[model samples]
Target: MPTRPSLDSIALMRQWLLLLVLAVIAGQVLRLIGMPAADFLGSMLVAIGLGVRGARIRVPALAFKFGQGCIGLLVARSLSAETLASIAHDWPVMLLATAITVVMSLLVALFLVRYGDLPGSAAAWGLSPGAASAMVALAEDHGADSRVVATMQYVRVVCVVLIGAVVSHALGSDVTPPQIPTGTAPLGFTVPANGILTILVLTGSVLIGARFPAGALLVPLLAGSAMQLGGVFIIDLPQWLLCLAYGALGCYVGLRFDRATFDFVVRRLPSMLFSALALIALCALSALFIANLLGKDFLSVYLATSPGGLDSMAIIALDTQADVGLVLAMQTMRLFGVVLIGPYLARQIIRLSR
Candidate 1:
């Protein structure tokens, strides 16, 4: 006969089941409200609550790697010939905006290091406007508190999403958000050859890059982007699959927050909020200058210059009918810029802080 399940094992199963159901509900609710990264936020919130209440759960290391890989592919899907051409057409303006944005983020990180309780590495990684999950992984490699880095990143994400929408609407994109869902839509409702190939590509890339810092995300991202832009293969992923990846990554981060780490964040929450708003304001000001120089619409320029929130920015640009291509080109450039320069910059900030 098979061995009997222990009481602890059965209870753990129940906890996991509850976590799944609640996470999906929370994610959908947030999504309906136009929150960026709803799935990640939803699952994280649920996991944090459960963790604080004495629930024992953990995401596997492999699961975390896979989650990072999915995010890489998500970012990669936006890479296309059109996006590249847009950048080439506006290379000067694009380069200026990207440089200024990176500087602004670093300045904010420097402020946090000088005055806030966070260490320099944590502040730098947390304040970086690149992909939130990718930043957190890099933070881990650099000896920052991953929990603190995560809080800083997602907090900024929330602020950026809300402000981006309000600005787009104020500048006269659709006065109301469109009912359509945002970002790279899945190839179809069904999985096809492209989807399978994409999955294989993601898995293989992650495995290949597994030994490096943020290799899982960085490798797949670069590889998938090149292949997609070169017309090597169409990158397709089902909605359910991406959701699973998002949830896995969120839960892994959230569940790892012990009571002490959570308390540390709560005490510093106000500082984090201030930094987020400041970054958005600074970026908005830059957008105004860039728009005047290029003779473009203010809304389109703002969306392009908005720090982070690539998907949310895309949604706002499309729904409000802003210059969708320009916004994507600028945002994608910043995404890659921060990803490439982030590690070196974070180290420099840490050194300067000391």
Candidate 2:
């Protein structure tokens, strides 16, 4: 007879089974109700609840990156030649709008420093629209309080997603069904050549992306775009795969909110919520100008300008049938801009505080 499984193995198995069941139930219920980012929102809530209950649930980093890569490919498929031309012509406006976002983020960070009593550097990194994990990882190295920075970064994420969904529903934008491209082959089917190229591009880009900040998402995106634009390949990913990606990404984010962390931030929750709302408002106002300048819809521009994660914004764009290309372009530009200059600006903020 086989030896009984170790306790750790048994515990791990139980955790996986629990998460899988909850994610599926939550995902199906949300999907039926026509919710935006249903898979993500549902799985995230489940994970968060599990964490609060003291279950050891975690979505690996590779899982998050895989989800990002899938999204990058999906967004790339939407970028045809005509859309690329539109993006090229509007590059200047996009650049300006991105610059404005960075400035706005810095201003908000400064406010947090002065009014919230957070360390200058921590406030800056926390409020920056760059990657939360990246910011938190770098914050300590730069003398920022990692705990505060993490708290601030994740609080903003939770607020952005919840408020964004409400805003979309309020505006009547979330009612639209997922708009798959008309000319695409049936779901679950892909041409072999297209599939091979798609796999190669995604795998290669992800490998290279490991070396660059936000590269897991951005690099795959660039690769997918190049492949599609160059006439090298056009693959319509299966809906199931997309759903899996969404779930993976959602779980990755949701599982991070453990009970201890949640408890620690409870007293300060109000300020965090207020700060998140304030930043979103400022970004929305800026979006109005960008929308006017670019002649796009206010909703699309607002989502693009919203200081949330790129993956989150992409999901919103896809959900609302917004111009995914423009949202991706604007968000990507701002991401790179912030990553490049955010450190220097953080230093300046620290100096000023001193």
Q: Which structure among the candidates has the greatest lDDT?
A: 2
Query: Across residues 39-60, which tens digit of lDDT does each residue of candidate 2 receive?
Result: 8888888887776666675788
Q: For candidate 1, give the lDDT of residue 21.
A: 97
TM-score of each: 0.71, 0.90
Each candidate's root-mean-square deviation in Å? 7.0, 5.2
Best candidate (score: TM-score): 2
Predict model 1's lDDT versus the native. Answer: 0.75
Off by over 4 Å in 2: 1-10, 174-190
TM-score attained by model 1: 0.71
Scanning candidate 2 in windows of ten residues, the lowest lDDT window is 180-189
Error of 2 at 140 (Å): 3.7
Candidate models: Cα lDDT each: 0.75, 0.79
